[model samples]
Target: MKILNKTMISVLCSSLLAAGPVRFINPTNSYAAESDVENNTGFNVENSTSTANTHNFSLVNPDTNIDVDIKYTDNTVTVTTITNGAEEHTFTYNQSNGFALLDGKIMNLEINEPDFVIDSEETLSPQISLFATPSDKPVFVSPGNISFSESVDSVGKVVAVITGAVVLAKMIGVTLPKKLIETKVQDALTLIGLGSAIALNTMSGSFTYGLYRTKDKFYTGYPGSVNSYQYKFRYQDMAVNASLLGKTMNINFSEVGSWWFQSKPM
Candidate 1:
């Protein structure tokens, strides 16, 4: 009887091993399942590079939405404003300096003073200022400082030779008065001075307090002035790509409308 019971136990164990683990389930539906993940909005990086990046942001104005586009690089920054998907204004700047290229002119940016100030019915625009280009030549001195040292030396030599001749004649009893020699020498010097003045006037045109205009071009009396009037606009951080060697990135500016006048050459 003991041998038969041990044989049955071995067979049962072998059958259980072959069947593996089993799952117990109810015939009726009663349970539910769920996942651990949460829902969220996605994010994206528009333009990414080792040296620069571009980002888009929006500003809500009184009744419209303003889209601002900014591009930042190693040493330069540029900012552009767009409305209704149409470009308005684009401003560019050099990070090393506060100088900006706006409205076809190189402008100096100053933000130390008050944003708005009024005096004597004059309206001062904010952020930037305009300056007139004194002249195409762009000089610190009008007509430039001139020197005629060689011409003066030549005039003096001629006068000396004439004086020596007159003195020699008198010493040899040739009847030439010293007064006459002096008067002639003085007259020659006067003519030289007059001639020099005429030549200078011709070379540089008329100069008032400063050279206002030349034959075909106009000039301003102020320093660092350009051909057109200076325009001021609300300052915005500009987007720039310093890695760009000599290539220019185009940015459309429509905020203040098209440039009123052409930009003068540097």
Candidate 2:
């Protein structure tokens, strides 16, 4: 698998530290909402008063002053972005067509249906493998051994480990050292059977968390053959991670340009 260079990782670390955390708060409520009503996807909802078939909320990032209004009805989800109290852009997604429309125009993007497999292999080993594409061709494909554990649910364990690392780093100090960030990334990668240096370089760019496998096998067919193994997994909502400056930034990936990340003080 192709890995990200050290220079790229360093640049990403610098950018995230400078930007700081982007808080997600409910406009209707004075306090922040901690739990999600629909899914355990970590997104904070603002308003929950809507028809039983429809769900409405706003994702406001105070740091950026960007308010994203999301409405879900049946299998259709519409996202509208408002900046500086003005509508900037809007996008709609329908579960029936699996296509996203931007401002009423259909875009050249396709949202693939998720294919989840649960078998004996998953019961034996659990790991996460990432595969992403900007177009029809995939630009990033990581090995299935990104995060592994002896536990039956390695995916959950990996998420907990990364989350704990972020919290621990925040407790350490405001300005985190480079070594500390490297150490945390290395620790998580080590659990998946990869060296520290390899893990850091491999996870430098846009990486998602939902593509995983419970089987220990990394690939199926021959490496250079035409029938070589390929990843066909996709999900509507994906958890994206970026480890920078001793903190792991968690972002939910819904579309190409409609993604947001939250950073914490460390």
Candidate 3:
């Protein structure tokens, strides 16, 4: 009976070893299995949603380039130019005074009356200004300056040369007509003296004051002066054409002591 009991105990132990451990499962739901499935599906959906959001963001914004910047205030207008995404030049203009500030320097604008009157009365003589150097300085030119007298003297000399040439030709028995000699001499003198006269005028004196004209207004200013070797002239008062106050002002240098604005070259 002991041997049989021991043998039965051994067989029970072997049967227990052959069978695996027991596991408990909830009848209501398989939470672990459902949780894994849901987690996997949510991860895939999140990835797809993230990709779509990135594509939409790229489409929403495309161009982000800036070239110029302009700002306006009650009294001033500022214009800034940009090159290669970098600031290049800035220009500011004053609406009230018609003055402009370029970079850091101030540009003055002087408005003259319609009658071009100087002092208190209107004058028949017109006064003008010229620029000698490429700089901002201006030199005032008037009839009273020594430079003007020199120009007049130059014309007289040219006349005298023609007269002398005519007399010399008669004395030499060339037998050329006085009018022909005069004409030929005058033409030669003009050709030879044209460059010299221009040089002299440019070097002797220039307009220290700049005159600018707009649609309905005339502007003028001293624009400061420079220490130049050229001589400068000034007058107590001067007059100019009030009608020149139009759009697109041009610098006129037809005469030494006079300047005016015209739509086209005169």
Q: Which of the two candidates, 2 or 3, achieves a greater lDDT against the reference?
A: 2
List the lowest-lDDT window of 10 residues for candidate 1: 202-211
Q: CA lDDT of each candidate?
A: 0.26, 0.31, 0.24
Top candidate when judged by TM-score against the true structure: 2
lDDT for predicted candidate 2 compared with the true structure: 0.31
Tens digits of lDDT, candidate 1, 154-190:
2222222222222222111122222332333233333
RMSD, every candidate, angstroms: 45.3, 20.7, 48.3
Model 1, CA-based lDDT: 0.26
Supply candidate 1's per-residue lDDT for 226.
40
Cα lDDT tens digits, model 3, 1-266, are 00011111111222211221111111111111111112211001111111211110000002221122334454444544332344244445454554444444442222211111122222212233344222222332212100001121232222222222222211111222222322333333333332211222111111112222221212222233221111111122211111111111111212112222221111
**Shift in Å, residue 251, candidate 3:** 14
Q: Could you give candidate 2's per-residue lDDT for residues 193-263 as a string of tens digits?
A: 42111222222222333323212232332455432332322212233354432344454423221111121
Q: Which candidate model has the greater lDDT, 1 or 2?
A: 2
lDDT of 3 at 42: 9
Relative to the true structure, candidate 1 reaches a TM of 0.21
